[model samples]
Target: MTTILVTGGTGTLGRLVTERLRADGHEVRVLSRHSWPYAVDLREGTGLAAAVAGVDTVVHCATNPRGGDEQAARHLIEAARRAGVRHLVYISIVGVDQVPLGYYRTKLTVERLIEESGLGWTVLRTTQFHDLVLQVLQGSAKLPVMLLPAGVADQPIEAAEVATYLAELATRAPAGRVPDMGGPEVRTFPELAGAYLRASGRRRPLLNVRLAGKTYHSFRAGGHLTPERAVGKVTFEQFLTGRFPARG
Candidate 1:
């Protein structure tokens, strides 16, 4: 069985990826800051050598949205090289280069670092996760009125679907920078919010606000969408139903 190391294996995507890898009869090592023996902070990167030792593939799912992604990636690259890692699989956003947000910019920077790290690498750019969209809606629903960006749309793919694909990629030869993947449908902010409200049986006044900023403008322009490669089978409605089933 191939030996694989998954960083941030405790997170949403990483957890699923780890499960898929293990199910395929591969030896999977989970790297996290809290775990013993394999615990190592990617940003600090102090003890990463031990975690990466004898690892054939390293799936980088650890990311810091607030900051420090570049530093973490550099340290991980060095450790992977030292451990003789054959494949470095990375998950990135679809419009990382096109979006003007700071987080997106950082993701783009990490992608560049991996490409030039001199190691075999595979980077898959995908649209937003359904979980993130649901989180945004849940946060907005806290207030009496839900405020959303006007005209913004998201093709929310299931996290499990992405995880399975990552596991499949890890078991093969490294394919650098694969084609973008997206969900089945591109639903607008209004539609997504309405769906969440209906599914959760929550009532709130909805207001679509046109915010000023290059980032929001880019989102409005669908910079983060991949309609051409909509290969995902699960729809947002189906996801909601799974989360909140109807009473018989």
Candidate 2:
């Protein structure tokens, strides 16, 4: 039974990975800010060793959404190295290298750190999660109308499947930048928003705005979804139906 330490164990993916690993009869340790059986803050340099003690592998699911993700990831990678971690698995997003987004830049930097650390590592790139889709839909409902970039493409996947893939990666030898993961079908943001609205019984009108910007152009060119490596079973429609079956 390998002992695995998971950073950001309180997050959506981390929590699920921890539970799955524990159910598989592996020793699971969660590294979080608050007190737990073990507590560690990769940002504040607190309780790291205790959390990783005797762990055979480390799954890095921690990320800073507002900024500072690179520094935070660096801290965690360094700590794992110092603690003699055997393997490291990093959860990253698809199209990180293709997009110039700040968060994606940080993820790329973290991937570089893991590769340069000379440690056993695997970087799994997954598409946006289903929850993010719902959140975007809900958040945009406040405006006069939900706007979408004309011709923008997307392929969102299930968070649970990503977690399952990460858990599987945790047990395997570091594969070094595995194939990108996405849902089976590719669709547009407007379509997804419409589905979400229908699923949630919302009457918000979706307006397909022709955005003329580099970001919008990139999205329109399918920078968000990977076609060749797309390998997720749960379609966006399936996920929405599962989450909101009533379609109120």
Best by lDDT: 1
**Pairs in steric clash, model 2:** none
The 0-to-1 C-alpha lDDT of every candidate, in the order given, reads 0.93, 0.83
- Across 76-189, the per-residue lDDT of candidate 2 in tens digits comes to 777788888889999998877887777777888889988998789999998888888778778888787987767887888888888888999999988898888987778778
Q: Write the per-residue lDDT of candidate 1 for residues 61-84, one digit (tens) a residue.
A: 998798999999999999999999
Off by over 4 Å in 2: none
lDDT (Cα) of model 1: 0.93
Estimate candidate 2's RMSD in Å: 1.5
